[model samples]
Target: METREHSATAGPDVAPPVLTRIPARMDRLPWSRFHWLVVVALGITWIFDGLEVTLKGAISGVLQEPGTLHFTSAEIGSITSFYLAGAVSGSLIFGYLTDRLGRSLFFFVTLAVYLCGAFLTAFSWNLWSFILFRFITGMGIGGEYAAINSAIDELVPARLRGRIDLIVNGSYWIGAAIGAASTVILLDPAIFPVDVGWRVGFGVGAVLSLFILFLRRHVPESPRWLVIHGRSDEAERIVSGIEGQIEKETGATLEEPEETLAIHPRKSFGFGVIIRGMFTLYPKRSLLGLSLMVSQAFLYNAIFFTYALILTRFYHVPAGKTGLYLLPFALGNFCGPLVLGRFFDTIGRRQMIAGTYTVSALLLALTGYLFTVDLLTPFSQTALWTVIFFFASAAASSAYLTVSEIFPMETRALAIAFFYSLGTGAGGVVAPWLFGTLIGTGSRMAVFYGYLAAVVLMLAAAVIEIRIGVKAERISLEKVAEPLSAKK
Candidate 1:
């Protein structure tokens, strides 16, 4: 059977449908069925990924009604923090589990947990209830990085990995865009009540999980994992299936028939293995991981969570128009990789890492000045906001690309969770709180203080990378090698 996109939506939920048609090969790499399966799975996970954030972004709209979950700002922050904490825990735990167990079963586990959270979030009557639900959702989201990335990393050839990874990760923003836009599209006080709109938004996200579950049946575990785990029988079976699919759709012939080769199995899976596995991979990678996490957390939270709030709270823009204004920010996110990802391989991951973070930091700093001094009008502020976010998204995607690739196969998932929790989840949890609290304090100056600090920190990392590049950025994935080839 030919595989299609996991879900064809604006973000990861919606994939660019997979066809039975065989993709032409560049070099020896033929487009294979297994590869497509990995792509769709990641994309679907990402679609729900956006829904998680969009639901939170539209909280103000939901709470407008008198009886719906009346909660204080601090309380709201605490609840949101739980979601982030859950994601963090999920990522760390799942990363090791994927390495120890396999990607196959864990995918279902994550999705199932996420679905439970999504429904509970939609049905929750109070703020705390929503938080509890959202925490479950976060755990799924946390597992998302380790599980999806591990599956794709193992299956997709290194050459195409950079571009594919960027595309895969970039879909999250598209998810965010569609999710945020849905809030505006479904805005009807008469037909769709405010709280109901938010509920529907989450329900839409959760409903997507079901269709993806259907697609999951078509997905097999990574053949590489099979080979690593001493499951050559299953690996060969999967390889044969993929080859058969390729031959059917693309009319391509394999260079050789699938043959049994001695599979080199890793040591037994255990908690000690993950702990030792990470350090054995190179101690510096962990430091790079930490920096990436800190930079990514601040940059993402600053933009996605805060941008819509800026339009509504500061500029007095209507809720509907806020989505439109934020559209540029989302579009900026989608375009960043298309423009900069080409450099990940050529300039080498290190240089692109430095350049992206450096430029993003600079752009953000300028955004602060523009806002701080009141240089930009309401219109320009929004436009400038989008411009900065464009670079921020690029920086974030690039950061993850490097972070995901550097660790040893044994610790890859665990390392990703370790860094990602501090970086992405921390950002998601805090961005709203920091901005909301500081802004509410009647100090517009707080935006400058907060963002300026982020800029400086991000730039510092770029500078360090310039001096001595991290190994992950230097090791290019073989699959997307051509796409990231040096620009002339």
Candidate 2:
């Protein structure tokens, strides 16, 4: 029987809708090869992002040395800031396209865009060209965060969503770990010229994107998206194909989907509608998402972007040796989500998110105080960061998970983009510069002040989350938040 109806907004060009069990069909499936395909194809986006941003920091000192880019600490900070600005712009722009144009299109486009940016970065002749390339690369990654996060959340099984999302997001540090290890060799003056090693580092990310692009081809668009856009027939067909593939792979009888949602097919959403839905219809979710985004963005950008500078400026670590410190830090961040992700599913989102955020804050406060008093060596400092981010990374990753799952199906991509851009723009774009200035001042006390600010913001966010967080675990997307086009 036909399950969908036309909204007044769906135009004559829209096809007649049919009933689809796509959402239920998707959410009820067991883990299969198909899920692995999606994870590898879409999730590597974080790896590229981890690689890109980590390379920026990992090579900061290399760029400052003679016969390289000859950049100053401030210039490196500015370059990183430009990348964040590009990311902000990209998220807003591509985010809208993902919602309007469908997830399948933007996944390919964004990956290609990133490849172009990362490849060109290797050819940069000076700081200006380097910044321009970095900005372009950032735009690609920013777009990926919106489109890919929306797709992943929409498509993954409800029971597995929290852990999978956290793991995928945390996988950024896997890239960071790879970047750190590679830079240790790439930045070695004995093996390659100082100038050539850094350029090769940028090329590695572009090369990695080629593999992901191939894997993404077999992945399908969100059936949830197709049905709401008056394409329920297509949605049903895709889900059927998915079920067939999963059954063949697992050789187990698939359970029938019990839930079905009816949506009034929408042609498109206007800017005014999107804005209203985000701010008016879902006000608390909006605020919670913003707080999470901003706090994590502030702490991550302020510290990670300038970490090498801290090592070189304060502890006298060599430019090449900086990666050795970063490798352990990246592992700590990576392991956090892998270890703690399941708890977000089992223990509940509110308790886990709030607890992680609060604990990370306390750890940071202790770490900052120790640093201010000159009680930390380079080794101890990295150790503290490893422990601190063991919690902070999961909290930061949950920030992404929260924003993606809390809104209506129609607004998922744009909402992700909006929060990411706002939070990242407000916090991320300014953090590197702020920390750069503090590092420039050569004062441990000055940098500690920045740490204090991050702690306060994190605590405030934890309070907000505890009070108003969405307990979205093991719930279908439509149940968590109804489709905007649902019949009342």
Best by lDDT: 2
**Segments of candidate 1 deviating more than 4 angstroms:** 1-28, 32-34, 256-267, 312-314, 318-321, 429-431, 441-445, 470-488
Local error of candidate 2 at residue 129 (angstroms): 2.7
Model 2: residues >4 Å from true position, as ranges? Answer: 1-19
TM-score of each: 0.85, 0.94
Most accurate candidate by TM-score: 2
Estimate, for each residue in 1-488, the C-alpha lDDT of model 2 and write its tens digit: 24645455545644444456778888999988888989999999999888887777778877898898799978986897889888988899999989988999999999998999999999998999999998999899999999999999988999999999999999999988887788768888899898999899888788888988988999999989988887777877888888899888888878887766766676677777677777889999999999999999898888887888888898999866777888889999999999999999999999999999999999999999998999989999999999999999999999999999999888899999998898787677678778888889999999999999999999999999999999899999888888876644
TM-score of 2: 0.94
Model 1 lDDT per residue over 259-291, tens place: 222222443456675675566535666677677
Q: List the residue pairs that clash in candidate 2.
A: 3-19
